[model samples]
Target: MTTIHNGVSPRAHAVQAAAALAASMGIGRFVYTPILPLMHTQSGLSASLGATLATANYVGYLIGALAGILIPGVVRSAAVMRTSLVVLIATLALMPTTHDGSIWFALRLVAGIASALVFMIAVSALHAHLRGQSQFLAGWGFGGVGLGIALSGVLVFVVRFIGSWGTAWLASASLAVVCAVAAWGLTPEPRPIITPDAPGTPSSHRWFTALVISYFLEGIGYIIAGTFLVAAIDLAALQWVGSGAWIVVGLAAFPSCALWAWLSLRWSRPTLLLVALLIQAVGIALPAVIGGVGPALISAFLFGVTFLGIGSIALAIGAHLQFPRAVALLTAGYSVGQILGPLVVTPLLRDGYRDALLLGAAVVLGAAVAAAVLRFRFPSDLDADPRTATSTEEVVFDVR
Candidate 1:
């Protein structure tokens, strides 16, 4: 394991990374879900415009991901992470100041970009500092997103009774500020020095292609639910049920990565990935098929548990493949899919969110089918060159 600067313990590093994720991913990016209902009833935000705003954010996320890939140095800079955190905070705070849809879109777009940068920086830091630590440490760090989600959900749930959508946005921004303070000292991963390499068995490109396709499909399916699940539940359940379900989602998600990491020790990543997708598909479709608070909460729980787990497992598999720029390529594909998710289901939104959720469920099943393809003749043993194998192992750990 690489030594952390200033004698920061691995646990402390994970905590900082988690705080960054909580602020950037959980509060900044996803606070929209619980707040969407308020926008609809309180602010006259139509379903079409809502979907459009969501798409704008995803587009911005793709751009940010591309920037990280193109300029690798930015991923290693604490300044970049801090700037993104500030930008994210500003975006959330500014959201309530205007009723103009265009301004909302722009704010969300910029927030998406900042969220992506924070995510990349936090993940890089976790990978660098907790290299050989228990996978549970990284899993707990990822759970920070869940913690943020739960906290924001609670905020919105309370504000819905006493305030308006603008209040929700402002409160979320305040929460992000608190998280940013905790993450202020986080260190980005240092750039590695390249050394002469030894020959090793080349990873199977065919499998890598399958992995990419599966992950891309997952991006589409996951974001649809992430954006609209609360709204969908609100359609059929009590007024409080929607936000309550969202809170359930956050609670379920908080420990999901750690659970998945523990399971990965006993099961192959591909198998676990496939199972998770299948479970998520069922969760997404549950409320669509059955209407009520029970189904809605259950759906939230299942979706929350699997979404982050899927990402962690998929990225770990990409690292194991040892393909060149595999993480970047996979991330790009996933981002593009996220950009398409809302647009692909926009037409369905006119009827209601149910059709959209059903569509999302089907797409996730498609991703699972793609994952199943990876189970055949998969390379479980990599007894190749020791140096190459060690590097791959480090990547897998980092990804987890």
Candidate 2:
């Protein structure tokens, strides 16, 4: 009765497959994050150019996310993933040759698009097939982000021996190729039959819109901490701590997601999300204003603890809102916020990136406000089971 493509049993296969895809996707996010310290000295990168590169990638992500949401074909095919991976590999390889700002920006933009497509398709597949699975399993699958972050960080450190960023790209490309192949078999194609909603289906659009706004604000706020925290730490002249701190963040992230999601069963999901935003805001702002190594590590730990489970929580919010298209809209809005994060922060780097942190804090605080608004505006749905992520439930939140 069960098939490997559809989730054979135990959900182990789905988790494995999801982890592989998440690792591949997350490897791209942090590849350049750790190297911010070395960017200007060894790589001839300027603050503005660095910002441009980040913007390009995020913009591409926005475009690609839209494409995936609008065009169903983009989400269904193994070939789409293969092509996206190849693009990711090639774009990363081109990073060293980016002497001209225009070319570099354009290439990164392309890479972002490819990354968005790959990420969307892979996560959608996992959500579709891994229904009824424990949120812990899903959290574990997403923990691949930690693994990817660790591997990429180590690779960057290794590249320091060769003193070539290009080699780092090549090595990462090789590893991604391996993971891609392993993941290929887990990828899904559409089945002929489609299920329709039962009578008196819930309408959760208001909640969905609320979640989208919160997710978008989170995208902006989190990137400030995630992308430039390295630079901020480096600016404080604690380069070693800064570099190692990311490893801590990655390590903490592995288990925190599942733990937090599990906690949601007893607590309010919106409250948990607000707490996460507060924690992240503190992390971002602490390093922005503080100078001590103790502060830096504390910030990293808090960020790591809260960063995971965001997308899942947003998706859960959508489910509660009863919105038919919440996932697509949320992903799109979040991608846009992601694209804007680096762009808005570039000018502020001249001010020691403090301005960026302040902005990020503002954005995250905005998510908290949005969450509060959702709670106050939609009180009736809070008591209901909004997390319809069961195997028996449809994978509608997988629109990303």
Candidate 3:
């Protein structure tokens, strides 16, 4: 086992991990959402094309996640983390150089892959370095994404004055550079060597199936709202309302993981997750049905609050299952759902974002149903060590 450097508390390492996620997952992977409207308003990018670009990024994320699962050695490498961070910066910087949609798609794809590598490396490092530390530290670390979102939202708002989308991309990359520098000294623990579970009939673990299915459905449901929520607001409400909503999301999300972790101590993970999914469904649908600045802001707040919480609780349940590579498996399933989300809703774009929001709500409702089933079928599966709830849940999964 490896310990953090002398004088560097485990909490500091957790902060470093959070900063890495803020840069990679929040800024690198998600800065796109705030930027999408800019591209459409200024660059004449169509909604269908924007959805295609989002899917391209999600595909890259899925590929990157699969690599992490299949090649653990690579995921644990410090060199890989450093390289991915640099490449992610480069990809963002490159975005401004090209106006071609194909080129933009390729850049987003590469950014997605680089962001995943940085995210997985940062998270795995936290698990190793922060061992035996309070799980609340991990919660704060996860809050980095919301912080990054807020930062990027503010940047984009500044861009509204500057009147250039390119500057927003460049500024976001600079922030990533700062994060990379801060996290450069962060060290990863030696990868754990685990004995493989003996082969058995897969059907014996019905609960695992339900968990993965619910997580997968969550992937599909949450993303449509995440990717389009700001864009929808911009179109339906005031121009500033979209970016303002995104900032609200960031503010609400900052403390959500820690709040959810605290709640998990008293409530079962399944019940907590089910409740989150149900609330998130309403959040996702609110803007579509209600139609106003208030509802838009409320949607952003509720969506931001629950999306991360659901991921935390669901993956925590995966850890409780004690399956080999449980985290990796759930990640893969969730990634697939993300890839499918924008693509599944592309046809609905012709009808407008309201249809997409409604579709997202329906899928999230399905996810809630799955969570309810998990709770009913596996009542005792929610027990977790009071001190450790698998910080893997803390990773700021973009569009989760």
Candidate 4:
């Protein structure tokens, strides 16, 4: 019989969780970035339409996240995860059948909802299953998103050489299905033990508020870059350059969480978050300013390396602060920011994606400043014993 903490192997659980993230969050949610340019060339998809579709997906993600928080039993069940995986696969498979823009929007919106359920469910289950395991194991599990990104990027790239836009979506669906099967048995983790907070006592309100603001800002900045980096590179450089850069982003992101987790042992989480945001700001700007393959690859590397690490550290910090419903709160804010990312920059696309990229960099810089302020305000936040934090508090995987 299963208990709150069980005898599952951390490595096995981490690998399975990573596979789930790669399928649902990476391929299901994000395979669109690399494929958007293809759609533009072959299917007459305009930049404005693409941005609208992205916003639709973000809206769905917000709705799905809210569902997870409100319908706790459903989101926590393995059946939901399996159902989400099937829905994600079906969305990808169905994308090629529709030529209408509204239909595409509807497909992506459903995909977004499915992706969020798979991501949150997997993370919640894995957190419980991996309890008492090395924190590094958890970090490795989060790297699955990066792995999925890389795999999907490569699939799109290869299909571009031999196939059309529809083929790319189909190929991505096939890959996602395979990953879903691999992760099938890892779910339905034992229900976590809950410890109620003392009534009338809130912990670290100032620091928590600052962290959420910074994370929300980071979500906006990161999505602009994440959603459009490939298209931006395609406009400036060779077609292959954009896809190659995306692959680099995936490769760099795969190990980043573990690296940041290791760094957390020595540095404060806020300090690491600030530094990562700063690096990401520069990274997001490089493709716009440099416009060459070398600079584009560097930009991808920097973006990948920091984005996941920043997320891991920020969630960990939330736990440290003992913030109630911290993950749910932060995720909702972040999803809202993502919805705003494309809509905020729609007017700028008439000029070119360079202005949008620069805007992303500026927002990230603002996020860095937020992190710095938080660091200064609560220098001792990291000194709290993380071991005392409830497992339920240790929620979220950097699924993007």
**Could you tell me every candidate's TM-score relative to the true structure?**
0.94, 0.87, 0.92, 0.94
The candidate with the higher TM-score, 1 or 3, is 1
Give the candidate order by descending lDDT. 1, 4, 3, 2
Worst 10 residues of 3 by lDDT: 391-400
Report model 1's TM-score to 2 decimal places: 0.94
TM-score, cand. 4 vs. native: 0.94
lDDT of each: 0.86, 0.69, 0.81, 0.84
RMSD for each of the candidates? 2.7, 3.7, 3.4, 2.8
Off by over 4 Å in 3: 1-7, 198-204, 377-400
Candidate 3 residues 43-109, lDDT tens each?
8889999999998889988888777766767667889888889999999999879889999899889
- Predicted candidate 4 versus true structure: per-residue lDDT over 1-400, tens digit per residue: 2233345566777888899999988799889999999999999998999999999888888888888777767556888899889998998999999899999999999999999888887887776676566777778898899999999999999999999999999999999989999999876555555565412124478788888999999999999999999999999899899999999999999999889988877977788899999999999999999878899999999998998888878877776666777766777788899999999998999867999999999999998988887777564634444444243453465321
Query: What does the lDDT read for residue 351 in candidate 3?
Result: 63
What residue pairs are clashing in model 4? none
Candidate 2, residues 239-355, lDDT tens digits: the string is 667677777777777677677878787777777777778778888888878887998888888888887766666666665554545555666677788878988788788867778
Residue 115 in model 4: lDDT: 91
lDDT at position 108, candidate 4: 93
Any idea what lDDT model 2 has? Answer: 0.69
